[model samples]
Target: MHSLARRALHTCNVPRDLTQVTFCDSAGEHPDRVGLDGNAAEAVWRSVEALYRTGVHPGIQLSLRYRGEQVLHRSIGHARGNGPHDPASLPRIPMTTDTPICFFSASKAVTALLMHMLSEQGLVNLMDPVSYYCPEFARNGKRTITVHQILSHRGGIPAIPRETPIDVLWDRDEIWRLLCAAKPVEVDGAKVAYHAITGGFVLQRVLEKVTGDTIESYLDRYLRRPMGMKWFTYGIAP
Candidate 1:
């Protein structure tokens, strides 16, 4: 391991109370008694605990699994915040292994998986032009762009203009129109600039157009529901 990695691992010291951890098993066996190397497993726990103690990150919940067995499960710090540390001040909810946390841009993999599932089911083709499903995407010289290009971050529209309000990113129709009307920074499939957020909106619209269901609904039916995940969705209702 590099010095930096060693330093990080060494610096990660969790509070004594935070050390309470659990392991999930099929036959209700303890993780240590199951088959993982004790040192390796301890390292994973220490690393996750250390991340929570970094102070840069407010909280963390980490679970490691092998062959369908959760070998290590742990949570540390407050999901809300440390707050006043007094019961009278405010309620500081401590984070737990089962806490509902948002994945943010980490959600890209889930979105990508959804697209792959669609392709696997023969509902869409990765090689087909995106315009085949969402014809409006053909505007602004993007008629030649392929689904593979978008998935691989080669679809020219990595971002909307800087002046775009943060709120519009969630306004599906406005964001979609802007993306469709915008010109590519480079030729389709010629460069690999991660779309960051733009590609998700565009691809989501195309997905909805093709499947006749909202992206959220599609995910629930094809991914989350079957997998037994309840809280995973595009947005939380406030």
Candidate 2:
């Protein structure tokens, strides 16, 4: 096997054959989706390589899958930049198969899935009042708001006030209190705008309270363990 192919398989827990990568479901049942996109994958990788030609080298990695199989894997750039050749004072990054970078956003869909399961098992009613479980939630005009409002981005409370201490982020109740105390800008469900950052925490608390389970515990017991995927994070990992 090519060294890059070998490296990608080892790091990504995928099979060696980039041409036809498929794996049996861990649930011991049917196959999920599988395969690779050749042309589009080439276009994406070439675009990244083009950026380096412009002297704007950035750490870049691309992974593309077709159906469910990974067909393209490319990592390029440096943790630090390459000197003057860098167009700045950074060291040039030589792309390798396994360098880490952080990207954010998309916990919303995962949180939504959690809600789906909750609704599925009848643990909570999405359309029911938030105050039904969190009495303080009713303090402001939020008394009638539903978990569905929060999940769908229909919750009036969008951006948290500026400079709210970062330390308070991981505390669900603290964030919940802020949300409850704040006034809604919209009548629940009139229009939905992206919550950006604050939506995740706000929805998280409602989910936690209604189900009587911490988000961590809920994710562990229901989603992660069930699907066998571990892609959750609230803060710095130990």
Best by lDDT: 1
**Clash count of each predicted structure:** 1, 8
Return the TM-score for each candidate structure: 0.75, 0.60
lDDT of 1 by residue, 108-150 (tens): 8888898998888888898898899889888979898888888
Lowest summed-lDDT stretch of 10 residues in model 2? 22-31
Query: For model 2, how does the per-residue alpha-carbon lDDT over 1-238 read when each residue is reduced to its tens digit?
Result: 3435434443221223322321212232211334334455567656766654443343555555455444555565455543223333444445454454444676678778887788888877888877787778777687877778888888777788897998777666688778778887875589887788767776676677777777878888875565444344343357
Please name the candidate that would achieve the greatest TM-score relative to the true structure. 1
Residue pairs in steric clash, candidate 1? 12-50
- TM-score, cand. 1: 0.75
